[model samples]
Target chain A: MSAGALPPRVRIVEVGPRDGLQNECVALGIDDRLTLIDRLADAGLRDIEAGAFVSPKRVPNMAGSGELMQRLPRRAGVSYPCLVPNDTGLDAALAAGCTDIALFAAVSETFSQRNTACSIAESMDRLSAVARRALDAGVRVRGYLSCVIGCPYEGAVESRKVADMAARLIDMGCYEVSLGDTTGIGTPAQIAALIDTVAAQVAVTRLAGHFHDTWGMGAANVWAALQRGVTVFDASVGGLGGCPFAPGASGNVATEDLVYMLDGAGIETGIDLRALVDTARWISARLDRAPASRVARAFPPTPER
Target chain B: MSAGALPPRVRIVEVGPRDGLQNECVALGIDDRLTLIDRLADAGLRDIEAGAFVSPKRVPNMAGSGELMQRLPRRAGVSYPCLVPNDTGLDAALAAGCTDIALFAAVSETFSQRNTACSIAESMDRLSAVARRALDAGVRVRGYLSCVIGCPYEGAVESRKVADMAARLIDMGCYEVSLGDTTGIGTPAQIAALIDTVAAQVAVTRLAGHFHDTWGMGAANVWAALQRGVTVFDASVGGLGGCPFAPGASGNVATEDLVYMLDGAGIETGIDLRALVDTARWISARLDRAPASRVARAFPPTPER
Candidate 1:
């Protein structure tokens, strides 16, 4: 349980612009979203989820994703990946000149159907087509397997089912798969078990942890996954996103909080903690809500205060 | 690590009444304080820090602690321990017919002097006298060592210093020693190293973790300690305490959040999570603040909402 047991360097997948804002009630314009993304890059985040190429009608908050993706500043060593649900979304991403795209699936049947309007098997079949087309277009594809631990619709998801879906995504040309506790109900023990079962099917190095802070177990879950050799993590600046099912609950773990923990552990993340906190504060102001990160709250009080 | 690696059951020492509320701006009457303690016991908390026997001028929130202790319902298994800083406080506790009392010291020299108006050596000398007298009175004495990880005034504190102080407290007749992260600045790696060094001097079973959630590392720190075989933890019901220096930062990790994680991990805490969350909400309402717990926030929205 020493620092040696954890990875020397951790790659954080900043999901604020996409997953974080997508679930927010307030809709930011493409310009505001671009500002958030720029701030994140300036804070030293290399992997940023810029936007999702889904329909604007269903998700008004993601209305200008295609435009946002096109206007994103392509900084050196920084990659902005967009989420593409089906072939149409893949087409939109391609039209917008997206070089990296993320494909998502759910391990739970009810969640898959509710989230994507298709069964788990059908969603995979659709994602397989999108992945094949995106790869053929020379785009690097990453996979997100949601509800790997628990589902709001279905209480507990079987680890075997998650592993099977992750293996399928890997087979479909995904370089890495991120296991997500969508409900944020997972404990460290459950996270450990899920990672242990899934790592057997997918390489441990190819696994990332995407945890929410709904139940305040996000940091502990990340620690568990880190101990099991998962280096990459998905976090949102300002701890954006509220659970639609569980109102007032947090969504993605805050990037500032994650960086604070990693920095304190002597784990190199290449991210500046002060700049990250500043960015969290900036974006939270734009969103008109207090940053949901404890680290951000713990920062020196603003001069206005 | 799996669930089997963790201890089967954990002893939670509820510090909300003393450590939590002592820092709050709003002061509750003794009746409200008694109600909080009663609700905590109803939620299955056995060890509660009822109040501090310090001066009312310094900490007006605990003015009627002696009277509060006299009015406490003598439950079958519940034990309410009050914080007694010096011989005068110990005498006050004894006069109140208290059977259990706690003594606190700081690991950092500056924090010891700043917090207790005495150096580390002097504070220990004072506490040793208090511990001796309390033990001779057929009372149980617990020890709290603050700034074990980091100090607001002294930056980083050495683990060796913390271990030495802990050993001294143990030798002076404390049944258990609670290591506190007063600044909430310790990470899992540091926590692991601290526990590893301290456990060599004192039995892990007699050590407790009292973490602050200022930087969102509380649960992770608790997990690290749990992995090192430390089973007891000190927590506040609503994450009640706030770091006086770090404006807007959290103080103690919420008891409800801890119970949620432990319950999800199949670890027996003997505490009902729903009941705990209710208590958190109730106390937070009385304090006119939102519960600083993700689990409490994520609970099914109140009827008023």
Candidate 2:
């Protein structure tokens, strides 16, 4: 597709509070997490992933997600999607009064087994039941498919497998499916091929691009996906988090970088670039590290322009 | 254009020693610079820019370029191009027995005045004279037009001005014109528009993309240019250099990142990714900072992955 074929507007699903913080070395308290979500909302983000309801022992960084969710201010037009891996996590999200929830499954068998202690088929079985319960309760459910491109353990993942998994998620009542390059090992061509294969099984409009900047192909991969009519993306505020599988590797593509690119392309994202940059700096300072975003580094937060 | 329309092979002009080192804080001695160039050559980069022959007082980092040029190893098929700004710089390059030289002009008027103490027309006159002299001496001259996308002093540079400058350089006996995003403020759409406009004046085959990763759009911009049928790109090893005007900003796109992207896309760059990463680590160690490349950071030059 040509550059003119890019989506006119994109929905950015802010994943900083959930995916970003989960892999960070320093975990923020519930208050800081609330402020981050508020700041993100104030910056014009309507979809924000608040936190995951995983076991606190497994992910200490997300321990107070339930309490934080309970204390979260309800803003009209803004939805905070919390991740629910199973019935227990879904119950926690429900207890926190979450109306939007996300479920994740890995396409690669090794990643599926290692991350959730189940095979791909079993993980899908569990997620299908959870999606049923969430939809029955009137909660919107989104699906996340990891290792859509390549897996650290499995090397190369077949696009056919990813397509099958994505199709299954949609059949299970997911409103949208986010294809993740979990290891950040995908290039633009690989991203385009994956999107093409998956879009054949699921509507392109119902797909989102979840890319990591591990090899610095995150933005390029997003561009490739955009050319293929994928209109939603998942990004972290300050490019928070590192690949647990690859130490020192970058995590999600920074929301600020994504906004800068989309805005320059005349694509409306409804995000305030300067405000988002400020949020990036504020949170990175709290994390006691410089923001991993190239935009954040180029335009420093001090004496804001 | 579809991803299938991408070029089958690309020529990479490695500018780590010249453009990359010029803006870096640490100035390497001639010996270390020689080693860096050698390592890059060993990694399969044929078009390596060795250094610049400018005033030592202006750019102290390139003080020993004349001597460094004389000592550069002449590997079969490998060509070392040195930047020559004016008649004096041309004389220095000739004295060093350099056969390949590069001339630079800015598309932004204010940047031209500030960077070279001359107007755009005047800078062109100087470069024209230099190009004439180098061509008379049988030296191949390559042209560089900085701020092709945007400028620090002048916010938005007209694409017409960039096209005119690139065409003029080509007319002045320069074999190829490299369009540089000096401030690194361009998005992919802007890049595509600029390429389309400039390619109208100059053959797309005679053009190269030189991008900086200031806002993390370098790789995406490259992808945009690739779709436009421009195959040559200028990259720096380890993403050396910073925007001299924008203090904390990034400089050229990392060669490792570019090679990784190209390799994964099934595009031939003829460079070994592992060796390039190793060289990035080596040079970054000398500069006492981490390599500014996400690829380098993700695949640390550790126990050899």
Pairs in clash, predicted candidate 1? none
Give one digit per residue, the lDDT tens place, for model 2 in B1-305: 56788889999999999999998888899999999999999999999999999999999999999999888878989999999999999999999999999999988888888999999899999899999999999999999999998888779999998999999999999999999998889999999999999999999999999999888998999998998889999999999987434546687999999999999889999999989999999998898887888888887445733
Q: List each candidate's DockQ score.
A: 0.73, 0.79
Best by TM-score: 2
Write model 1 residue lDDT over A37-89, tens digit each, in one string: 99999999999999998889998899988888888879989999999999889
Check candidate 2 and list the clashing pairs: none
Model 1: how far is B71 from its true place, Å? 0.7
Task: Please report, in order, the local distance difference test score of every candidate based on alpha carbons.
Answer: 0.90, 0.92
TM-score for every candidate vs. truth?
0.97, 0.98
Q: What is the lDDT of residue A221 in candidate 2?
A: 91
Q: Per-residue lDDT of B1-305 in model 1, one digit per residue for the tens? A: 55578889999999999999998878999999999999999999999999999999999989999999999987989999999999999989999989999999999999888889998889999999889999999999999999998888878889999899999999999999999998888999899999999999999999999999988999999988999899999999999987434466686999988998888788999998888988999999998887888888888754653
Instruction: Give the per-residue lDDT of model 2 (tens digit) for A92-197.
Output: 9999999999999998999999999999999999999999999999999999999988888989999999899999999999999999998899999899988999
